[model samples]
Target: MKNKMTSHYAAKLLTASLLLLANYAFASDIVFICHKGNALNAKEIRTAYTAYFDEPKIVDNKALRPKLLQYLNMSEHQYKKMWEKQYFRRALTPPVVKKDDREVVDYVESHDAGVGYVAEVPHGADVEVCGK
Candidate 1:
């Protein structure tokens, strides 16, 4: 009985360790993605998506906001605070297409101009990593 209990505990520990490692790898591997042809850099993405900087280098079109903020390091409250300021200044328009990572991948795959972020390294032909 003692040996059996020991083996069960050992197995549980190994399983827990594997799960933790997998979670870490997934989080560490997540990367920002965009349309293949958008030609956007991190600064442009930040400016276009959020009012992180005033007098931001002009990028032609703006997309969704919260999703982009989620992509970046900003929390929802932080994004909202910045957005309120930008709204008063009339500096930004929210994005049209709201998509999660998989949807972003699907959209980017189909539309040449579609842009979005992913939680893992982009692998498809139409997706590009906009930021690290």
Candidate 2:
């Protein structure tokens, strides 16, 4: 009985921690990043990401996904629906999903037309900030 109670409390603590972490991530500032010479501004970045631009896009799934969606003025469900429609109707592939900011930066660095959002851009990476 004591063991079970301990485990239950532990689980509750973990769940609370995760919820707090998620809220922190959501509240954190995000930045739009692109290839070093890309000329996308904040407004253009919004349109490019929400619309079906030909340029490659990277999504950092950890801390930035929900925040980016919020910036794009959509929810996760809405974003998925949009991508699904694009994929099924127009055969447009969705943005590539990266594990974290580092991979997102790396992808944008290599692709001339790449764009992505991150919680924070790493130091010394050759990426341009489109907007915050």
Candidate 3:
């Protein structure tokens, strides 16, 4: 009886562990990052992404582009169209697109007013996480 109970508990524990892993696999939080000493609120970050704020140059990781657009309540097509229109009307530059987190961190670190988003907040000293 003791052995059977132990086996049952082990099975339950394994199932729980698997569930937790699956949840973590599907859940990724995007952290907004900027050059150290440059802080921005959510509104400011949104404006920067939309090219409304030219002070901070915006960098975007291509992988998280969809997630960022969804956060802004926009589809990828709509976001591109809006930027296109803004470019024609205002000659605003689009966000700099980077391949991954490392590149983004490097860019933001080099540019004092650079801002970007990453799937996970980097542990580097050069960047500050402004929002999540």
Best by lDDT: 3
Error of 2 at 101 (Å): 0.9
Candidate 3 local lDDT, 58-112, one digit each (tens): 8989988877876676788889898898888888888889999989989988998
Error of 1 at 120 (Å): 2.3
- Highest TM-score model number: 3
User: What TM-score fits each model?
Assistant: 0.47, 0.71, 0.75
As a whole number from 0 to 100, the lDDT of residue 11 in candidate 1 is 100
Instruction: Give the TM-score ranking, best first.
Output: 3, 2, 1
How many clashing residue pairs appear in each of the predictions shown?
2, 0, 0
Cand. 3 Cα-lDDT: 0.83
Model 2 over residues 18-39: C-alpha lDDT tens digits? 9988866674568788898875
Distance from true position, residue 110, model 2, in Å? 0.9
Candidate 1 structure lDDT: 0.56
- Off-target runs (Cα >4 Å) in candidate 2 are 1-28, 56-60
Q: Give the deviation of candidate 2 from the true structure as CA RMSD.
A: 7.0
Better of 1 and 3 by TM-score: 3
Position 116, candidate 1: lDDT? 54
* Model 2 TM-score, 2 decimals: 0.71
The stretch of ten residues in a row with the least summed lDDT in candidate 1 is 55-64
